[model samples]
Target: MESDSETHSGEDTTPDDWMDLAVDSPDGSPAASPAATQKPSEEEDFKLSLITWNVDGLDLEKRPERSRGLVKYLNLHNPDVVFLQELVPPYVQFLKEQLVNYLMIEGGRNGCFTGMLLKKSRVKLVESEMVAFPTTKMRRNLLVAQVIVNGQKLCLMTSHFESCKENTAERLKQLHVVKRRLKHAPDDVTIVFGGDTNLRDAEVTKVGLPATVCDVWERLGKQEHCRYTWDTSANNNKTFPFVARCRFDRIYLRPAIKRGIPRLAPDHMALVGLEKLDCGRYTSDHWGIYCTFSAE
Candidate 1:
């Protein structure tokens, strides 16, 4: 975890917002042939660099030029997939222009949208859908997509849960709904579902479905690794410095079968997009985070 994560700014703005490749021989080669197609290495089998960010749509409205920096950051970091919340038209349009190689699947309307940006050059999109939680007034939505990479099917679901501590029940219900949905995904695919949960340790711990989903941050033994995503102390966002700072953004993995559990390489995990512009302003109110996942 970065010490700069000491205090994330902007509370409950919930609605507001990989690995090296090993080339395998294409020929139907055998391991012994030394020239035939070889089995995909674990890194090649499940390699993924995933990011989740809540871009504080409201903040972007004030400083829209930041979009350029956002685009530049994405290009520089270049994660394979990005989960975004509180997306606005300009930002979406900017991404379309800048991230021309990505397949952007957006959900919801202008005010509060959620979506995923999959790198078309890296993964093949097989299917997709969007989901809405029934019990919340916040009108959050989840974006789902299935992509094939290196012949492995991965179910990717990103969501923005109910916002504010007041909607704790709704968030919990949403988690249960997500857990139940993931619990039934076809066994042939690896499941990963997460986004702006608007949740803290208190409620998240209760969202127990160990056999299904596990917080990858915890798997790395860095529970507070995500603390600065929405910290008040880190930036000059509207929130007062004393306001509580916690990470509302997250990414989790659900092992479809015991055989497909993951091994998270620590080097690829960290909070990103926190760099200050030459003008000393942040790229966004939220700091993006990403991790590399490979089958164990």
Candidate 2:
């Protein structure tokens, strides 16, 4: 658990100004593979990266330039897939136009905004749907998509949750619903689930994902310099507005994908994963995560 000193720093923000992968193998049979239980390779061959961000109240009236910058930043990574929360409809179209190569899809009511973007060059969507929250039921929708990455079948889940500390239970229920929907999915197909979890340690443990799940940030350990993911430079450690942010947005992969191709894929040498994009230049209330993977 982070100490109050850590919590009070305003590293993680909600709403308002606070705000906000991969490779190729080939198409295969629908049958599930034993991929989930496979071990991590001595050396990772494929590279894939993912970013989960909660754009703070994005709309036509809001930060259009920042929004446009975000689209460019995402394009920089050319992420195999991107999960975003707090998306307004117009902003969604804006991103799709800019990310013309991406197959864009979103859900969670018309206003709540949660969606996923897949690079057109890598994957095609086979199916998609939404899971709405209990309280905001129709207000916040969970968007799930099955995509073919590097020729392997994969699942991407994106979402935003009801605000406030008390909504934690409802949020957990939402996560479970997401799991249940994918229960029948082949364990071999890689699963990347993330969005604005709206949770610190207080709520994560309660969700209790199956043993197969792994949060990339936590798995990477706390000693790393870019650990935090929420907040701006004013809130950062003071070097850069985007530096020293907290970890809020995230990318969690199932055992299969993590083992098949576990590497940080980035455009920047500092953000090495896959693709060639610079990350430090762009500033956002939330930072992004990118990891690359390959099929076995």
Q: Pick the candidate with the highest TM-score.
A: 1
Task: Give per-candidate clash totals.
Answer: 10, 28
Could you give candidate 2's per-residue lDDT for residues 1-296 as a string of tens digits? 11011101111222333222111124532211123223324342255556667765443333555565566566555556777777765566556544556667756334546667776655678887665555664366567787766556677887776555677677677667766644555756777777776666656676666666666666655436545555554332124533444456655666453345432223221122212223323334555555555432
TM-score of each: 0.79, 0.67
Number of the top candidate by lDDT? 1
Per-residue lDDT over 48-139 for candidate 1, one digit per residue giving the tens place of the 0 to 100 score? 77878877766744344455556666666666788888776556655654465677777754566776788765678887766657666877
The window of 10 residues in a row where model 1 has the poorest summed lDDT is 1-10
Instruction: Give me the runs in candidate 1 sitting further than 4 Å from their true place.
Output: 1-46, 60-62, 223-225, 258-267
